[model samples]
Target: MVSIIGHHLINKEEGYQILLYLDPQLIEVADEFDESFQNKEDLRQVVNSYVKNRLPDLKVTVIRVVLGSLVIASIPLLPGTEIKDLDSSQELNLKTEVKEVFENTPQEIEKDLLLVNKNNSLADNYTPLNLIVPEVPFIFKGFHEKKLMAAKAATALEELFAAAKANNIELYAVSGYRSYQRQEVIFKSQVEKHGLLQANQISARPGESEHQTGLAMDVTSPQVKFKLVQEFGVTKEGQWLKEHAAGFGFIIRYPEGKDAVTGYQYEPWHIRYVGQEIAQKIASQDLTLEEYLA
Candidate 1:
C-alpha cells in the first residue's frame, strides 16, 4: 500500500505544509515512490486524467495537519484523496524536507505569482483559470467583466474586504479582471487622451496589464470618490490596506517610489494576491514583486 503524496511547502518555518495524498486506488499501478522520487509528468497526468473525467464536479479537500490540529486549505483536490494522520515524528521530518525545498531550490512559478508587466507580457488569447466574481461591494452597479477575479484571489479579496468592514473601514472594488481587448481599448483611449508617454505611465498597454491576470484588483474608498488615484493611498482605507493587505494574501502592487522598477506610476489602489506567505515576505522586505523575483 503506497501513498502518493504531493506536498507543497507553503511556509516551512511555520510548519505550513499542504499535502495532497492521492488515493492509492487513483494511482495503484504506479510505482511506489515518495516525494524524493517525484515523477512530475506521470503524477500530473494521473491527477489530470481523474479530474478530466469528473468534469465540472472536481471539488476536493486538501488537508493541512499542523501540530495536533487538522486545518483545511479550502482548495480543490483530486477525488478519492483521504486525509491520513501524520504522527508527530512523521510531521517533523516532513517539515524539515519542506524547509530545505523552501530555502535551497527554485520551484516553478505559481499562477498566483504570475508576473504581467511592461517587460513580461501575457498573450492576447491568454485567460486566467478559475476566474469568479467575489462577493464584495463594487463601485459600479451592474455585472461587468471587471467584477471577476481568479478564484483564489477572489476568496482572499473577500477576506480582506470583510476584515476592512470589521474595522469600520469601507472599501469598494473598483476594477478586477480585464480581457486583452478591453485593455487594448483602455490603452488606446489613454494614449489618445494623454499621449503615448503619459498613457504608458498611467495605464498598461494591452497584454502588459496586471488586470488581465485576474489576480489584481483596483480598490478604493468613498474618500477617493471610488476612483483609482494616488490620493487613495493616503485615505484611511488605503492606509489600512497597506498595513494589513498582506495578512490576507494581497500586496499593494505598486508603491509610492518603485515606478522605475514596475514601469508605471505609483498605483496604491492596485492590489495583487500572491498568497499569504509570499505577500507577507514582500511586504516585510518592502520589495516590489520584480525585486522579490529577481
Candidate 2:
C-alpha cells in the first residue's frame, strides 16, 4: 500500500534541513520543489494538502512538528486554529511599541476615569494612595498673602498666579483640603440631597476625593461678577484656564466636552495636581488622564 507523509522545517540556512519521511522512503513525488512560504503556518498548510491528496485512497495520519526557530510550530487539525504566539519575534524587536503609541494615554481609557500620575495611573481604580500633604503654614481659605504655595503645587500655583496677574486675570483660590470626616459629610450630603449621580459630580467619595490629599484646589476669577455660574467658563479667567492651566501642572479636569470620560460634566472649576512633567505630557499628547492610563 502506498503511503505519504509531510513534515515542516525552519533554520535550514544554519546547516538545518527539512526531511520528509514515510516509515519507508516514499520517494520524492517529484523533485525537492522550491516553494516560498510567507510564514510557518503557510508551509504547514502546503504540507497537509500535499499529504491528503496523495493518500486519498487510504487512511493516513499527519503529524506536524517544529524543527528550529519554529519554537511552537504545530497545529494538528484545522478545527480550532489559534495564532497565540503571534509574531513573537517581531514583538521582541519592539516591546515598547504600546508605550510610544500612548505617551500621554489617559487613565480614562475606559471612558470614566481621570488620569493622575505619570503612567496615567488613576486615583480611582489604583491601589493605596500615596498622598503627600504639605504642612499648613496656617489654616486659611485663599492662598497666603505672601504668594507662596506648598511645594510642587505651591510653586506651580505661584507661576499660575503670576501669569494671571500679569494679564489682569484676577485668579482666586476658592477651596482646598478636607479631612476624612469632612469628606464623609460631603458624600452624605450628596446621597441625602439629590442622589448618587449628582453627588458624585460635585463631591468624590470620602477616600477618593483629591481634597483629602490637600493637593487639589478649586480656582476662579475674582473679577468675574457672575456668582460662579455654570457658564462661568465663558469669563476671562475661565478662558485663561482653558488655554494655560496645563502649563502649571493643572488640567481642567472634566473639560468642556469630556464629561463622559471623566464621569462628570465639564467642571471649569475642578483642577487636579499632576505636576509639570505629567501635565506637559498630557497637553502635548492632547489626551485625558483616562486615555493615558488606559
Candidate 3:
C-alpha cells in the first residue's frame, strides 16, 4: 500500500511526483511507519532505525509520515522565507497584528476605536464619559444637548470650526451626542416615513448610530439653509471640512461610494473624532472607519 503525502510548504503536484518515482517496495514500508511521527526529520530517524534492524540492504529517505489519519511533512526553508521563532525579537511584534486583537471581541467599544454599525451595535446604556458641549456656532441657540460631544472631541471640534471661520467658511453645528432614546425615535420616524429599507440607509437603529458615541457630529452651512441634506456636502463649508477635517482629528465617516460597507448613505455632514494620528491615517488612505479599523 504505497502512499504519498504532501507537506504544506510544497506544491501538491510536485510532492506527489517526487514520491511517484520511488521504488515500489520502499513505498510499501511507509504503511508500517509509526503514527507519532510529525515531519520528514522524525520519519527519517524512525525509518533509519527500523531499516538498520530489519532490512540492512534497503536504504530509504522517509519524505513523509502519517500520524493516525493525519499526514505531515517538513520542507526545507527556502531563501527569503520568514521563520516564526518565538526566541526572535521580530516574532514578538507579529503577535500584535490588528486583526488578531480586534476580531471576535466587544472590547473595542470601551476603547476610542469602537466600530459601531448595523453589525456592531453599542449597548443602549453606553454613553461616552466626559461629555461636554463644544463652544462652536450652531444653527439654533440653546440646543445644549445637541451641541454636546466627548471632551477631546469637543476641543477638536472647536478648533476645526475656528479654522473654518478664519478662512471665511461659516459652519453650523446641527446635531451631536444623540442619546439612545433619541436615536430610537429618529429611527422609528424614518421607518414610518420612508419604509424600513430606506430608513436603514438614512437612520441607524438606536444602539447602532454613531451619534450616540459623542465622537460624531453633523455639520451644515447657511447655504444649505442649515438643514441636514445631501446638498450640504456640496457647500463651501462642507468642501472645506472634506479637505481639512482630519487635521483636527475628524473624518467624514459615511463617505460617498462606501454605503455598502458602512451600511448608510454618503453623509458628508457626519464627522467622527478618532484622534489626530488615526484620523490623519484614515483620511490619507481615503478609507471609511470600517476599513480603517478592520
Candidate 4:
C-alpha cells in the first residue's frame, strides 16, 4: 500500500479510499505487486501483464479501476477504438454506448455542465425548471422574464453580486434566461443589421443560445454604462469578475481566443453557472466551456 503511494499509483486520499472499498482480492494483488513496481507506468505495465495472463476477460474493467474513474469516463471513445474504424451505423452504436455509460454515471451527469453551441441546440420547447430571479442589481428596472435564471444559478448569482459589492465594485445583471422565440428574434435582428456571417459570430441562433438554458447571465458594470461590450473586459469590474467569479460558481462562457472552439465571439460579460468545483477547475485551466465539457 505504501509502495503504491510512493510509486504514485494513487495520488489522492479519495483514490486510497476507493481502493479500500474495492474488492479485497484486488488489494492483495496490488500489495504483492507494489514492491516490484517503480512508478505508476511500471505498475500499469504490471497490471497489463496480469490482465494478459490471468484476467484476460476483465482487462478493461481492471484497467479502469486502477486508473481512476475520471480517466475511465473522460475518454471520448472507448480504448483501442479508432474513429476511422466507425461506419455510420457503428458511429451511432458507439454514441449509444458512450451515452449509456454517461447516463449510468451520476457524478458525470448531475454536474449540470451542459454544452450549448451552434452544433448542439436545445429543443424549441425546452425550458429550465425552477426558474427564479436572482436578488441582484439589474441594468433594467422592474421584473422581466430575462431576469430569471435556474434556481441554483440564481442563488449563485446573488452571492456573486454580493461579493462584488463588498469589493466596492457594483456588478449588474444585464440578461439571464431567454425563450427560444426571443432568441430567434434577437438573432434575426442581428442578421438583418450585421449580415448572417457576422450575426452567427456574435449571436446564437434560437435554440443554440445559452440564454435559453437559464444558467447563464450577462453581467455588466457602470464603467461600461451597464452595457455588454468588448471594452468592458478592460474595466476593473470585469477584471475582478474574471479573477473571482469561480468562487461563486460562474465562468466566462466564451473567453477571448476561444471563439473558434466555442462557436461564438468572445463574451466577457457572459458568465455561465456550472457550480463551484467545476467553475474553479475551468477557470484555473483557462478552458472555455466547450473545452471543459469536451
Per-prediction RMSD in angstroms? 13.9, 20.3, 19.6, 14.7
Give one digit per residue, the lDDT tens place, for model 1 in 161-232: 999999999999989999989999999999999999999999998778889889999999999888888999
Q: Give the TM-score of candidate 1.
A: 0.64
Task: Looking at model 3, report the run of 10 residues with the lowest lDDT sum.
Answer: 86-95
Expressed as tens digits, the lDDT of each residue in 246-278 for candidate 4 is 998999998999988988888899999998999
Q: What is the overall TM-score of model 4 with all chains considered together?
A: 0.65
| Collision pairs in model 1 | none
Better of 2 and 4 by TM-score: 4
User: Over the stretch 223-266, how does candidate 2's per-residue lDDT look in tens digits?
Assistant: 55523445668888888876788888887766777766766667
Off by over 4 Å in 3: 1-107
Candidate 2 TM-score versus the reference:
0.50
CA lDDT of each prediction against the hidden true structure: 0.68, 0.47, 0.65, 0.65
Q: What is the number of backbone collisions in each predicted candidate, taken in the order shown? A: 0, 14, 0, 0
Clashing pairs in 4: none
User: Model 4 Cα displacement at 169 (Å)?
Assistant: 0.5
Pitting candidate 1 against candidate 3, the one with the higher lDDT is 1
Query: For model 4, where is the 10-residue window of minimal lDDT?
Result: 2-11
All candidates: TM-score: 0.64, 0.50, 0.65, 0.65
Error of 4 at 47 (Å): 45
